[model samples]
Target: MFELIEPIATVSFSKVVTEAFLALGMRNYWDGYFAGRAAPLGLAPAEVVHAVFYNFADGEVARHVPWVWGKTTPEEAIAVRERSSATVLRRGIGVLAEAPGLVRVADLAARAAVSAPTEGRALYAALRTLDVPAEPVARLWHAATLLREHRGDGHNAALLAHGIGGTEAHVLMALTLGMRAEKFDRLHHLPTARLAAVVDGLRDRGFVDAVGGFTDAGRQTRERIDALTDELAAPAYDELSADELDELIAGLELIAAARYKRSDD
Candidate 1:
């Protein structure tokens, strides 16, 4: 029988350097390292490693790696953790306190087939218990109800605008272009009557002023709604075809129209 021998595996200095660079999110350095070693390493074109490096570099994985390693002060980390935990706890408590009162009001409104006085009283009591200021809490509760009824529909945009002191048109344009009303109007061709109607509706709802200014509450509402729309749209945007994006825009227009109709009623 022929003698059989196994070859020992050898690692390249380039490989070590490349790994170190990758750890630092410097993917641009991979090509130079991989160029000559591709065949020996059983890697496809040297470019393959470069592509892999870019993929990791562009992704959150490489961006979030803790390079400072053990450099953070314990006190600083503790403070950050405490702040984050407190915020979460506060939000949880607020949700728990407010949600039951809202449910109770809805239940009473359904069972009594009458005014929401009992529900309002319960909500007031709950807000007091939670140490929430009365007026702001009431507005938030009302906005939450409107959001629940209108989410995923055009009415949600209208309701959000109403909450903020803006018209449905302003909200719709903001959602489409990620900009304010004047900017959106400058970029697109909207009829004056339609624009005026949307502005009027927003003003009536106390979401905006005639001069297209937002009140503090309106600004907060707009920011929240804008954030929600961005979150909802971001994941699906890359997968959507041009036609699909157009369809979505069309749907938004329909929703705007529906909001206008609601205001008319």
Candidate 2:
């Protein structure tokens, strides 16, 4: 699912999504990212977006949210995300975008998505309230987005259960992904002192070493969080039969391959 949806979901680098927001008077990366994701929340306050988004720093979300709403209505923003995502996805997959099998994959994924419960999944629920796209390719992208946000909501729950804050989570991910912590701080626009403080807190918890890599305990804890997130996300896939699951994965592979080819080109 990540392979198939990432190209469309990553509005930060998407030509269509970014260009659409530029025309709408949004000039920064966050303007499109925050507005596109929060469109379903409908003129929601920055704090609400910060809470549901979980990973982005509060100030990052605050800089562009309801403010983006001021420049373009939520309906218009949602239309842009949906329309542009569908457009780009179809172009990426070429002729396969029109195959009858594409419709079946969308149908299977949508069934699983809409079947997922809304309790504790705020972002997914908001998207659920909107009409599902009628176009087959658009509907596939929409279903994938619904499922992605659904899992993200669960991921946040897993982190909170283990007492991990958002910044700390990113620090852990930075180590896990072999990325530099300083780079993460810059990307999140985190203050140096604040990031240092978060790293100190993790060190106190024995999750990270002073040298900026995960301690054995830290690795174990991160592993547990990852497992729990998947466990929480498992129920969302319960609606798919074994055969249907196989069918969907195979169908998505074709589209995913095309997207990779398109990206390469």
- Writing each residue's lDDT as its tens digit, candidate 2 over 1-265 gives 5555455455324877788888889987669877888989987899999999887755877878778887898898898888887877888888888889889988988888788989999999999999998889888888888888888899999999999988889998988888768776544567778888888999999998879788999999999999998888778778998888888888888888877887799
Q: What is the TM-score of each candidate against the true structure?
A: 0.23, 0.95
As a whole number from 0 to 100, the lDDT of residue 53 in candidate 2 is 86
Q: What do the candidate models score in CA lDDT, each in turn?
A: 0.35, 0.83
Error of 2 at 24 (Å): 0.8
- Per-residue lDDT, model 1, residue 115, is 17
Candidate 1 on 121-149: residue-level lDDT in tens? 22222212222113322322322222221
Q: Lowest-scoring 10 consecutive residues by lDDT in candidate 2?
A: 4-13
Give the C-alpha lDDT of model 2: 0.83
How many clashing pairs per prediction, in order?
A: 5, 0
Error (Å) of candidate 1 at residue 37 is 45
